[model samples]
Target chain A: MTNGKSDLKRLSRGDTENSGGAIWHENFRQAINILRSHKMRSGLLIVGVAIGVTTVLAIVTVMSGLDKRVQQDILSVNKPYLIVSRFDPFAGTKDKRDLMRRKKLTSSDAEAIEDRCPTVDRVDLQVNAEGMMSVLRYGNERTNLIQVMGASHNFGYMFSFSIEKGRFFTKFEQDHKARVIVLGYGPAKDLFPHRGPIGKMIKIGTHRYKVVGTMGSRENIMGSISDNYAIIPYTIYEKDRSSKRDDYQIAITIRDGFTLEKGIEETTALLRKRRGVKPGEENNFYITTSETFKEMLGNITKYIGLVLVVISSIGLMVGGIGVMNIMLISVTERTREVGIRMAVGAKKKDILQQFLIEAVVLTGIGGIMGIILGMFAARGVAMLIHFPYSVPIIWIIIAFVFSSSIGLIFGLYPANKAAGMDPIVALRAE
Target chain B: MLITVKGLKKIYDVGSQRIEAVAGVDLEIGKNEYVSIMGPSGSGKSTLMNILGCLDTPTEGKYYLNGSEVSNLDDDRLAYIRNREIGFVFQTFNLLPRANSLQNVELPLVYAGVSAGKRKRIAMEVLDLVGLVDRAMHRPSELSGGQRQRVAIARALVNNPSIILADEPTGNLDSKTGEELMAVFNKIHESGNTIIMVTHEENVARHSMRILRLRDGKIESDKIIN
Candidate 1:
């Protein structure tokens, strides 16, 4: 029996006048209740989502931080755009050897370019010797495999080194070929602890060089050049017993408004003039731009990041499939509930939204927990490696959004099937 | 007329063959009426109740509820009518096992978009009416068959629908408990809410003012006893 008067009133006040928010909240609350009813199933579903988000977040954060460190290390060495060297490879092989024998870069070559080439702003000449070595000892413990570099006085300005304990070598020391050396922060602390390293005498192989200053901890770029080396004067390295005329590498900075191409052209012309290289002869030495160096490092990191993402994606995919399977089970288990809601004026859209939101909330909460755990894991890793712990905020946001969207996308078919159930059949189901 | 059906039919296609559940039926019921359609197994009384409750639309002919053509209505419209006009109780006392009596009573109002505060208040009032107010927080499994049936009745009354459709509402209870359920139904009818019940027991059908007996998919007799 139906009463028209009350039926119309109920229709107007009940379903028609309710806002979408009210419907959504009611459906969401019911879904939460259903989840509470099946605690084990809900927990399993959440763990799936947590695994997915954690893998993604961890991989992304580690890769992004490593990428930043690599870039910073490259920038500190040289301006990425300029390449200044003596070698010209475009002129052919026979001429390259001839040019190499005659036109090897030296300290004078760097000076001539700085004077003649308007594009050359600063010049740094580095001389490295295989015979150059350092001995680090702390109370009978010593390391013999320490590399030592001979650098100009402007080494700190050119390479962005922060003096942690003492001062850098002065211009007078470079000109006079002083035997004083500066120790990087790591080597200094390792060799001498609980005492200041400045004004200390450290033996480098057979020679005794005075420690003048100490460098700060430099960012490690994929373990390439860490703050564990020793810096000495370029002139002093040249005059040492193991030094030779051929063991030199020169780096130069370009002036403002000068392109790398111009710097390369001017430096090549100047070297050719100084070394008497014929027009048809090729240059001997290799010169690389900072941009090219960075490109090489970036390619390595890109390949590494790609591999990590692919590996992490495999984990996430398995987790996503698990989530989908669980949602399917949830739909089948709640068939009668779906039918009852459908019979009681819930639109198919309403049912769909309710289940989908439930899935998303489940995964979203899991994702948030995973992110928190992953951040701690990353921090633990960074601490183990003695690197700074950085939170990857961008990856965190992406993980959250991606996990919820995965829930929505994967939960759709099951939710629709549940919403389409026939009430009579469902209610009559034993 | 609160409900009118003319030549109502229901056909089910199970695999290759067609089975007629309700062949042809003509019936009218007025507001506040307490009526029971009684039949043996496979006699089609349940099919008639399904049509009357808007859980199933008639396969052919017209069925009107409160002067609205409901037989040809789509699924969404049928759902609206079911939620707004018909409240249902089943033989098994089909309350959601996970839900307490209060939440079970609030289910229909939730779909109707009633505010939570008002929904709870109305659900409590209906539970009080069914004498299950003290057992409101107890789930269906915690209650006896008689108490569970009372909880289902309270759920059916919470929406204040135009009619209550009970399909053997006391079918699972003892005779004493069944009598008590019928007494509750009698009190509900006296309160001016229409009720349509389907029962196989003649004694249960006798509680209603009117009875329609069905056999072989058609009404065998219709009688008004009160």
Candidate 2:
């Protein structure tokens, strides 16, 4: 009974020790000292972690930038519109030959959709001569080769943009196949650096066409909006610019009170009926929205990102295992010191924290190095490709936290082993 | 009484063999007493000293330090007692190799959660008491064996612990240096502190006011030296 009472009393509180958080400052110094003493081993672990983090950061930055570029291009029309085409525009070039096998959908199909699908508010047709890289020339001044598009009369309204300087062409001009042309800001600025381009006759290919207006500025990067393009009437293009390999695209806006999804459904049904596609068979053409383009870009990026992540994880895994092994060895090497510390009043928790901090400091330094290197790589590529320059601050923060967490995870077993040691046996260790 | 032990026992399992390191030893020590424990190599003197210092618990017995039974205390509380009540001086001096003499002395106070300024001040006081104030910044490897042991002694006294447990404090020092350390110990005892030391040498045992001899895990004799 007396022994039982003593055992019960033994479970009483250890009096809070009155020791504040200030006691562990020496532990931090000790951890730094320990890591410093083994420079080669610590350096190897840091490099390993740095490589993994670098891979993750570089891949994430490139993929995000790619998405940003695709989004900017897909939404440049500035309206919630549908693009009906022969194949998916944003499917990438991986399987071009297969996608090209689909049948073409012409201006006739665009006309039918506008008439049959009441959800369609307005429709515009554009055609690109696949290889028409025409140079625009003025008096002793010439601009680089850029594709010229043949658009309907209401192209400016459909694009939700007005001319920056002059007026858009009229329906009579499109119907009469007039020789008037409008230049995108890029080409307009180049051909008329010192003078106004409007009403000026510029040579496109073998013919002279008068510049009627200049499109407004959008992005400085050479995205869809800022492309150095020249636009002429659809009738003019069909007569003078249409080649055997021309590709036609139909842009449609949904009528008021119609959901985009409902409009798309109606258009798809009508197109299938018009194209004579059999029931239970795939459609002979593609219809995409801006959201659809975004989804396609996301799918491609997700696959590439996953692959890169797995590879970097393998690198980090190897690095983490290396850290754990060296930490175990460190615990063994410092067994006597741990015992002396215990005899001087250190709790098991104190020893565990000491080793854990050492591991984190080592990997934390690696994380910083990796972030710097990855930013350099991303910035270099962005400059080369003319993407918007930005610091991926979120990914940098995530990488740092992730690398520190790796140390915490891998350092646990070794630290627990150190803390669980019997002080007597540790003191007796040589 | 500063310490009391009733039928203390310690058993170790080495593979299938059961070894009784300490069996049925009863002892008492009063405040400010200077005592020495002596025995042959396998006579369990180390095990008994470890039990007395609360470094290891007794398997079957009662241990009271400062009038409270402490043998059944859990590890955290036992660590607290080790920090606040008992100071251990190892045979090898056990000074942390990389730490300077002052930092070594401040170890116990650091664990006690003493603030930085107070820890340094109190550590300096103990270093002065051990006559190592001039060598406070010198690490163990840079100091002589006797100087290193004095640093260890200063560390042991820094927390103002109730008892100092010395395990062959002079074992690594020359005879002259050992005699000097013994004189320091005598001075410490006269200034009202309890000290327990373990050694096999009779001359070293003579330095203490009382001597206890151990044989086969039991107390063979207890002698008082006036």
Candidate 3:
């Protein structure tokens, strides 16, 4: 196209010296006319590109939103905390079976970490089961959606849980196996709307426990049912619901001036010693910091997002090829017109630019429509999943440029074929 | 001299056959001359016209247009000379079907890099010159055969080219409409622009000041028409 411009400048002088505005304007206008004349073909082409762009934009937005939500809910509050568990949080079925074969972590392991690791400040042991929905009843208010967690006395401090109206259970209460509980904010609000939840008796599975505390709302956490849960001391849980072989997950917080890495390292060593893990074998447990957990979450989401992008790009490629195919047909159909253009003074570059611009415009329109549709789709999914809505400016730019580049790359062959036509033969075409 | 041709030959290789379309023709045409080349089908007049119009280059000779050798010029440079020096009217009245008459007329000037304002003014004036001012916005598909040819002629004249070349310009029109188009060409010629036309009909050749008759790829006669 640049060669054509310079040639025009050199030749368009003397007695015929008047034709000089950026010639692209005329070519662009002509291209638009051609596309408009073939409405159905152009419409299908636009829709193809739009679907490709929409897929990319929607997936990037939703996945990035989920990533941010995970950071806020898990990593943000637990940056200085580490978890020691019987199974990996990110385990596949094979890894799960391997970890299941190993002995479960117990309260002894938790106490051993605290006693031996210099960086450890305190440890909390929590025993919980899934797929077991327990209901809590207080007078006329009942919540069948309750989650039951049995933990040691320091669970609240380690996990950033604060008491709103009362005190947390003490070591004396835990040791005595007292029938006491702390209600999360959701259950507290639902059961005791106008009055304090402390000192109230709640029923759970033919047992009654006095509410020792009501928890403050957990700010910025997402997708956790903790708000509807109640906590009971591990001593009382061991006496009532848990058996001797029941496993416990431990949360450990580092002391001031210590990093979670140092805390995890020292604690892992201590557990290896306590559990008599052999020198040549893997540890019989999993230990992970919030940072590691966040990375695992990010990697999974990124992998899924990358696969989706690859799939969507194929759609874009098909759309781009479709544009090229239609443009080739157009060139063949208008062979006589091209000959006339050549006879009248259009340079080879002019013809090339004309067709290239047509393809780009076709896909550019699709990209714009796709962006709009993508935003709406992402927003819809975000709303459905309770994920926050965010504008992904970088992804939008990438989608636009990628779609336009697709047009350029694919449009080259047909445009070149048109430009290289023999004018004499073209004029003779019917 | 507006055009000078020396030892012009055009050979076509169709499969194994080497066919000489125009063999060893020599011709000279001075400025403001109204000349016609007459020949029967396959007698090489069309090949000669293609060479003179800059649509095709000669295989074995030199063509000089306005003192510059053009037979060996490349495609782009040939396109430039075609834009600036020669105006072409086809037998089919080859105006772009999608463009209106005014746009068709503006084409040559557009290739010459004429600005929009001047291109429009000149295109309008050329349309007026061809007596089709009222049909400026009518596309070729919308115009009668006479009007379409007039539009093609107007296009040929738009850049005020050195010579107007019409190839059987009246071939597609009825005799009456053809007469009307010849009158339009007579007006264009009287305006002092050199004109070269290719035709086989004697009546069409009679409209020119001089005639060259081609027989079997060679000039049979060059005559002054009184």
Candidate 4:
């Protein structure tokens, strides 16, 4: 009776020692144990995945952010369906560079299209003229070699420019060729350090023009184009300049519900007729739309993104291969252990899942670390360059999923080999 | 009968040449039977034990356990049989070295799809039966050889399988520890579970009720030792 009571006590205690949760938890525990056993190997494997995911994430965030900014800037400059001067008529021909240098559109041609093309919503003409070699003097400070631009009265509305101070020049001032000018934010601060520029006179070359308005701060597109220029009426530019050739560029916004393609077709026919070009002769002007601009920008960005993704994938591939090789080594090192498991009724699939899960967990942890590092790195770079920092959630999710899948795919061969091992032979393996 | 084998044979192929590991053998083991098979290296004792444990299928023969044909079963069905009816122990004290004694014992029940609470209770019961309840959380590496073997014994008993197959279970232990492990096996057998073991030592074979000695892939002697 004493022995029976002791046996029951023993049985109760033994039961407590032998059981846990579900099968997945058991497998997960075993998997974590195996990975922890080889600390250096597992650490190195995770580092590889981290580097791969970091590279991919950083490049993706920067590229997508740049893309969004460029699209926004383009839309601000012109509507999606608007057409602009393409600079060169025969740019696609063999002597494209030479043809580009020869083709120029004058303001008269822009006016002709506006009058003849029914699909055109509005026409804006922009022309640049040389400012006299003069210094912008306000009180005691001065700046040299500043660029100045001349535009029609509709320039502010057409290009979405917002006035930060005062107001734009009226149609009366523009028609009378008034010597009133609007200063960009940079020049405004440089010229007037203490007081407002409204009603003040600034000398441009030989003429004095009143500062009627000032533009807010604007960012340059793609890091090369400059937005630090002063604006005046086109009549003032023509009256002051000596050149007979008008290098005026035209921007034509298409009417609502009108396709850019149709607008381009009709505008092209009208321009050709107005330019007096015969049917056999090639058209002297070129037409470009915002969509074409976006396509060209996208192509360049796509190439950059492809290169970055490829470089990152190479890192991941190396990391995945490293994981596979190390896991194979683990199987060989633990051959007897696997044999014991098989003998004790662990199925082949069980062994397979165990190893595969370990690999995935290693890579998954690495991916998480890499994403955190990459996001901070990208934000640091954006801050240094004064660009808005954009956190790309989609790229973060993608990096994690991609790295884990790499682990599963690459770990398959090693796991299958382990599962296929013969228990007797494995037990005997040294 | 808990286990039945008829004309069991196993052949291995190496580079287009076939070598017979186990020739022909017939055996029957009833409930609560304690048996030992003794043989030198390569004498087919291990092969026969593997077939009995459902770890290997005979090249040509039929094996029935609890009245079901296991020799012709597919891998999934065979795995099911192994999980539900057979427990195994090995000379190396084949517990997962990183796992604690309790976790090692609970493995088979996990495969059996038992719930956590029930599996834990059963595993703890077996550990107590083997007198290792105090060391349940100790990993195999942390335990002595005898303790490791006892853990293996606890693991073998956890599933309440019909048969416990042990191969040289005390090969890595000293004689005194080996005797202690044998005592635990005796207790397990007294509980009405069949135990089949392969051993090379005469004293180890004498501990069982029946002994079979093999040479050159054939059983040279069979006797009722007790």
Which regions of candidate 4 are displaced past 4 Å?
A1-21, A37-40, A72-75, A78-81, A84-91, A94-123, A128-148, A161-167, A183-217, A221-225, A242-245, A252-288, B12-19, B72-76
Note the Cα lDDT for every prediction shown: 0.78, 0.83, 0.83, 0.78
Local accuracy of candidate 3 as per-residue lDDT tens digits, B1-226: 8889999999999999999999889999998799999989899998898899898998998899999899998888878778877788999988888788988888777777677776787678668767899999888899999989989988887766788899999998899998888888877777677899998778888889999999888898999885
After the best TM-score superposition of candidate 3, give how far the Cα of residue A95 lies from its true spot, in angstroms.
Answer: 10
lDDT of 2 by residue, B118-182 (tens): 67877786787788899999989999998998899888877777899999988988889999999
| Regions of candidate 1 where Cα sits further than 4 Å from its true position | A1-16, A72-83, A86-109, A112-122, A127-150, A162-168, A176-303
Best by TM-score: 4
Winner by DockQ between candidate 3 and candidate 1: 3
Q: State how far residue A395 of model 4 sits from its true place (Å).
A: 1.4
lDDT tens digits by residue: candidate 1, A242-279: 44434566777778898878888988887777777678
Q: Which scores better on TM-score, 2 or 3? A: 3
Candidate 2 vs 4: which has more DockQ: 4
Which of the two, 1 or 4, has more TM-score? 4
| DockQ measured for candidate 1 | 0.28
Q: What's the fnat for candidate 4, on a 0 to 1 scale? A: 0.33
User: Arrange candidates by TM-score, highest first: which order?
Assistant: 4, 1, 3, 2
The lowest-lDDT stretch of 10 consecutive residues in candidate 3 chain B is B110-119
Give stretches of model 3 more than 4 Å off. A1-21, A69-148, A152-178, A182-208, A211-230, A234-287, B131-134
